[model samples]
Target: MRIVVCVKQVPGTHDAKIDPETKRIIREGIKVVINPFDTYAIEAAVQIKEEIGGEVIVLSMGPSRAITVLREGITVGADRGILLSDRAFGGSDTWATSYALSRAIETIGDVDLVICGKQAIDGDTAQVGPGIAAHLSWPQATYVMDIADINSGSLTARRMHEDGWDLCAVKLPAVITVVKDINQPRVPTLKGRLAAEKQEIPIWKAADIGADPERLGLNGSPTRVVKTNPPQGRMKKSVVLDGPVEQSVRRLVQELRQRSLV
Candidate 1:
């Protein structure tokens, strides 16, 4: 049960600006924290490892500064960390991003399962995990609410949907993206923090992972943004109900019926 968990560092504030030219979030020099959702994936991986007895390795892709989140992962429970960083990976979209990640996993070689958050808060596309599965030609279960069981060769989890959840099972070397509902993340203990301080994380370059140059960064991405803008704000209205008790209730009912809110 060698579980690999993918985590990310996201802008800590809502004031994060976007690059107009590339249509991507501007991340340099910003205060960042681990993506909230990825914490659940980390917790899930740790729990699975605790149950089955194996190592939980955390991985991330970003600039050198993104190592903060990987260190955080180690402080919680992961055994080690790996970073995919290089100027060559700049401006990559979900497709290109997943390509590099899958290649890095391939370089690592004997991974049994890959886990990730349902989505990154900054991007919110929820595409990278599935894209990595596709690039690796592995089975994937997205929006997972819980891992029912996992052993040497196969795993089972509850997949979230609009109406309900489904019990999904897949073979080893599969990818799964988990939602925050899966579990509460454990705080980093004194020993864990101390261990994190001594760990030497390995950083991988594009060539180190055998990633094709033609499939990285902006040039490798097929999707293009014609324009980027914030969504228009919605106006709010207030109403007051003042009358005899019966009259007020009747008026409210009528208003609700008229607005089709009932």
Candidate 2:
């Protein structure tokens, strides 16, 4: 089995600044880390590979510095890493981003499965994984909490839902977005880190992945951020509801009513 795990580099801090002009996060000068969710995806892929004896390849699309996350995946267990980076891929929305990633997967060829995190913290849209599935015209199971079974032809996964999870069986070459509940990520050993540091990850440009020029970058992005505003600060006022249980309940309700928060 040749499993591909998709990872992303995201701003490490919650206080990431937004570019007023572009209405996008200003990533420059800020510390970047692997998306927390992607780590679970990596762990899932690694476990799958270890269980059945196959190779796991980590893939990402971002600036050159994004290579760090790819190497990080390698340190955990992935056999190799590939990066998709170029000026053309700049400012790509989820749609365009998934398209480019799908193209890269096609270039890799003969892939058995693709796994990704449920969402990226910075965006939180949770659309890219399904978008990739759509672009590839393959079956997809999102919010996967576990892999129940696997083989060369198909795999069974437990898809998480609001109430609970249900088993989903899909054919080979499918895509799945894993939730953190899937597994705990393994720490990179010193030896693994050294090997990852020495590994040369190939960076693929738009042309290398055969991505359509018209379907990349800002021009190809169907969605645009018209404006952005920071979340309004919460009220700092506090109320102490003391006395008997009924009194406290009544007081709380009164306070809530006064604040129009009931």
Candidate 3:
């Protein structure tokens, strides 16, 4: 089993600003951190590798600074890391982003599984994982909560839905987007950190991945953000009434009814 975990470097602060022209989050100068949700994916990949006796590789696409997140993955038990970075790869939306990653994965050769977080906090679309699967033409399971079984190049898992979870079975070479409920991510160990420091991560560009220029970066993305603004803040406050418990409940219900909250 050769498992590849897809990770991302995202803005660490909530105060990240957006580019008015592009309507994309302004990344320059913002502190970058590994997407928190992706840590669970990483953890799941490591566990799968440990159980199945295979290698785990972490892959990410971003600016040169994104290498930090790849190295961080190595420190958390990934065997190696790959960074797909180039100026031409900038301003990629989920569609183009997945295309780039899919190409990179192809360049890496044999892979049994791909794991990713359910979504990135900065962009809550939750589209990249499935998009990559589409590009790779592989089966995908999103919002996966647990891996029930893995054997003979097949996987059985539980996928979370609005009402309940559904059991799904997929062949090998599949993509899975995991939620935080999947597992608790572990901290990097001393040895893992040292190994990560000594590791030399390879960076790939569009040419390296044999990507079509017309299908990558901002130009390839069909969807564009036309406008962005912070949601207006609420100004109302709750009032406590001094009365019997039942009376308080009645008052609260009446207030809710008046406001159509129910």
Candidate 4:
């Protein structure tokens, strides 16, 4: 099986700033790391490869500096890494990004499965994975908590939801976005790190992937970020109840009633 795991380089800090002019994250000079959720996706792919014997290829789309995340994946068991980087790929929204990635997958060919994180922390739209599926006309299962079974033909996975999870089966050549509940990521070995450091990751440009120029970047993106604002700070208040247990319980009930809380 040829499994492709989609990874991303994200700002390591929670205090990432947004570019007021572009309405995008200001990534310059920020310490970067692999997307936290994507780590679970990588772990899932590596586990599947270990069980069934296959190649695990880590793919990412970002600037040349983003190669760090690709090499990071290799240190954990990905067989190889591919990067999509070019000026034309700049300013791509989820739709354009997924389209480019889908094109790259087509270029890779013979891919049996594509695995991705439920969402990127920086963007958090959670649309790219499903968008890739839509572009490829393949089945997709998102918010996957576990993979029960997988082979060349199909896979059975548990999908997570608000209430709980449900099992779903999808044919091969499908896409799935995994949640952190799927697995704990393994630490990289010294030897693996050395290998990753020496590995040669090929960079693919937009033309290399045959992505339509009309749908390549900012101009190609249909959606626009009109505005951005920092999240409102929440207020916190606490009261202490000291008395007999019954008395405290009654007091708590009265307090809740006063606040219109059941």
TM-score of each: 0.91, 0.94, 0.94, 0.92
How many clashing residue pairs, candidate 3?
0
lDDT sort, best first = 4, 2, 1, 3
Clashing pairs in 3: none
Local distance difference test values of all predictions, in order: 0.92, 0.93, 0.91, 0.94
Compute the lDDT of residue 213 as modeled in candidate 3: 90
lDDT of 3 by residue, 115-231 (tens): 999999889889999999999999999999999998758999999999999999999889999999999999889999889999999988889999999888888889888899888
lDDT of 1 by residue, 1-262 (tens): 7889999899986657888987778898778999999999999999998888999999999999888899999999999999999989988989999999999989888999999999998889999999999999999999999899888999999999999999989998899999989999998899999999899999999999999999999889888777789888775666688889999899999989998999
Model 1 sits at a Cα RMSD from the real structure of 2.2
Worst 10 residues of 2 by lDDT: 233-242
Residue range 81-155, candidate 2, lDDT tens digits = 999999999899999999999999999999999999999999999999999999999999999998999999999
C-alpha RMSD by candidate, in order: 2.2, 2.0, 1.8, 2.1
CA shift at 24, candidate 3, in angstroms? 0.7
The pairs that clash in candidate 4 are none
What is the Å distance of residue 131 in model 3 from its true position? 0.6
In model 2, the Cα lDDT at residue 61 comes to: 94
